[model samples]
Target: MPMTVGALRETAKGERRVALTPETARKLVARGLAVIFEHDAGREAGFPDATYVAAGATPADAADVAARADLLLCVQLPPADRLTALRAGTAIVGQLRPNAAHDRLEALGERGVTAFSLELLPRTTRAQAMDVLSSQAAVAGYRAMLIAAEAAPMFFPMLTTAAGTIRPAKVLVIGAGVAGLQAIATARRLGAQIEGYDVRPETREQIESLGARFLDLGVSASGSGGYARELSAEEQAAQQAALGERLRVFDVVVTTAAVPGRPAPKILTAAMLEGMKPGALIVDLAAESGGNCVATVPGQRVNVGGVTVLGPLDLAAGAPLHASEMYARNLLNFAGLLVRDGGLSPDFADDLVAATCVNRVGEKQPQLI
Candidate 1:
């Protein structure tokens, strides 16, 4: 019998993106695997049930899909209560943030369900096709700039009107990762004067290529796996002092610096907020992971001394259609490693498979291979 793969409707509140798209489902079916999804799972993302049916996917009840499938795919982790419906030894793949819910992970492990967390995918060229983090970050970054532009008092572009000439907004994006680069590009497209900064000096060229000036903070924290190393206390203080002076001059500030499983570094302080212009705007992309700004409140916007600070949560979720498409493709590519010709089995020796396996069936502890 062929291996069965299926997806359930995401149950997380306000989460609109579906785990599987009809386009990706068709590819899996072509590979000789049966594809199943909960009815109306893709409706919020604009793909109706008819679309999945046309693409060779069966739309069924959520429980039936969970009970029948050998490998379950998801966008958000399924609720803990729902795991009891899964058959023993069923494999699951998703972001599955281990840090957020150890109890749930333990429960799934004890149930003998194998879990794969894509967030742990190594930063290697070979893994680029399956990089959900970068794909979602691009969407978040692009939307963050628009969010900043809307909240700012001044216009993003310069205007030459009867009222003399209006100056363009001065924008600064901290962190030169995929999201930061997209933010810089979007801001530039909006005619803002953009400047980008990162602790990695190697990013200077990338920032320059995007037509944004790169700020030299005289500090480098380049680390393994394409992430900036955590700065020492002295280094953090020095960086804060130097950045505070420059930050005050920008009309819009967007901070995207973050490390996986770690609290975001505090870059903007309360004193710095008081120093900025009266109507300056700040968007903290690291808000969910404890924020890079002192005034950021995870999912709320607050005014600190006349300056507006926005800490957006799940910005990618706001762009449902494209985000779902990108994320679905990423999951499909990763799933390819485990499903071959029609059977569900993984080559434990493959680095990608080994690195992503959080918990296998019957294991007492997670194998951080």
Candidate 2:
């Protein structure tokens, strides 16, 4: 008999993406996995109950889906209440933030449920298909640039019109990760004069490849995990001074610096905002984990020294349909690696799964908190 997999309705506030779509359900069915999904799980994201039914999945209630599932899949981490429904030995896969919610992970471990966090997948060439963070951040970066462009008073492209020639906006992107690189490319496509800064000296080629000048502050604070490491107070001061000096010339700034388990580093100070041209715009993508800008308030827009700062939370949720599609593909790739021969065979020996799996293994205690 095949293992039973369930897709529960997303309970996270403002999260509309379903864990599985009808098309994905059909693929699982063909692979000999029984699928059960809560009725209307995908409705808000434009997939209807009838669609799942046509794809050979049973439309179940939330309780039934949770009770019957041998494996549960979700977009966000399950809430405390939902975690209570899992049977011992049940496997759960999703974007559970273990670093941010160690207590919740401990609870799941106590319940004897195997949990996997998609974000912890290593950035290896073999794991590219399962790279949810990069895929989602790509969309976020593109959208953030558009948001900044719209909010700014000046035009992104230089226009030689009959009335007068409008100068192109200057855009500065901090952090040359997936989001930052996408922001630079998107801004350049809009004809903006783009410049990018990063603690990783290796990203200089990447920044220049996107037609953006790479701003170097002579810092070597990047980590082995290919992320920006925390900087020393003295190094931070030098970075701040260099960044503040550049702020005065840029018409739009987008900050994407973030450390997964820690608060976002403050790269833009209040004084930096003061130096920005009047009516300038700043989009801080790290708002949810504190912000890259000191003035940023998550999910709110603030004005400082005549400059507009937008701290948008869950930018991926803003584009539900496409976001769901990309996320679903990532999950499917990950599941494919673990599920084989009509049963769950989570290969702990596999590097990708070993790095991503976060819950208790066998009788061992959880690795996190």
Candidate 3:
């Protein structure tokens, strides 16, 4: 018998995307897996119940789908009450934030469910198709630049008109990772003068390659995995001083500095905000993780001294259709790699699986809190 794959409706508030798309469901079915989905799971994301059915997936209630599934696919961490629905030995895949959901992961493990966190997917050529973080971050980066542009009082491109000449907006991006690089590229396309900074020295070239100037602090602050490490108190002070002096020059700043599983490092202090020109704009992409700017409030916009600071938490969700498409592609790639010969296999020896799987084998409780 073929193994069963199931997708549940996202229970998280404001989540618009289903874990699987109808197109992906059909592809999975062709690969010999029976696909099941919660009724109306894809409706909000623009995929209808009839669409999934047309694609060869059976629509069922959440509990029934979970009960029959050999592999459970979700867009977010499973809710506590839903844990009871998962059958023993089921393989689950989703954006299970292990640091935040450690207890829930432990519970899933206790229930004998093998749970995988998509965020832990390794950055490698072989795993590119399965990289959920990069897919979502690409959407976020594009959105962040647009948001910053909208919040700015002036236009992004320079204009020479009969009335007067308008200067182009100046943008500074404070990270050179996937999101930061995308922001730089987007801003440049809009005719803005863009500059980028990152703790990882190697990213300087990547930033320059995007037609953005690279801003160097002349200090080493990167950690393993090419992420920016936490700065020492004195180093942080010096960095802040340098940023403050430069802050007044830029018309818009998009900060994407964040360390995974940790609070966003404070890059723009209150004093720095005060130094910025009146009507300047700041978009903090790391707002969900506390924020890269001191005054940023997650999901809210604030005005500090005459500068508008926006901290949007769910940027990808704001662009639901495309975001869902990208996420479904990544999830499909991951599931295809793990399932073989008509059944799901938890190959702990595989680097991709081992790094992403958080639960131990043969447990009966949730491990993600």
Least accurate 10 contiguous residues by lDDT in model 1: 360-369
Off by over 4 Å in 3: 361-369
TM-score of each: 0.97, 0.93, 0.94
Error of 2 at 31 (Å): 1.0
Which prediction has more favorable lDDT, 2 or 3? 3
> Lowest lDDT 10-mer window, candidate 2?
360-369
Per-residue lDDT of model 3, residues 64-122, tens digit only: 98899999888898787875888898988989888888778887888888888988877
Task: Score candidate 2 by TM-score against the native.
Answer: 0.93
lDDT (C-alpha) at residue 350 in model 3: 89
lDDT of 2 by residue, 1-369 (tens): 779889888988889887798878898899899999998899888898998999999988888888878788899986777667778877888888877777787778777888888888877899889888898899899899989988889889999999999999989999899999999999999999999999999999999998999987777786777776677999988888887887898888899988666788888888888888898999999999999999999999999989999999888877778888888888878898778787888888898888888876453432321
lDDT against the true structure, each candidate: 0.90, 0.86, 0.87
lDDT of 2 at 39: 87
RMSD of each: 1.6, 2.1, 2.3
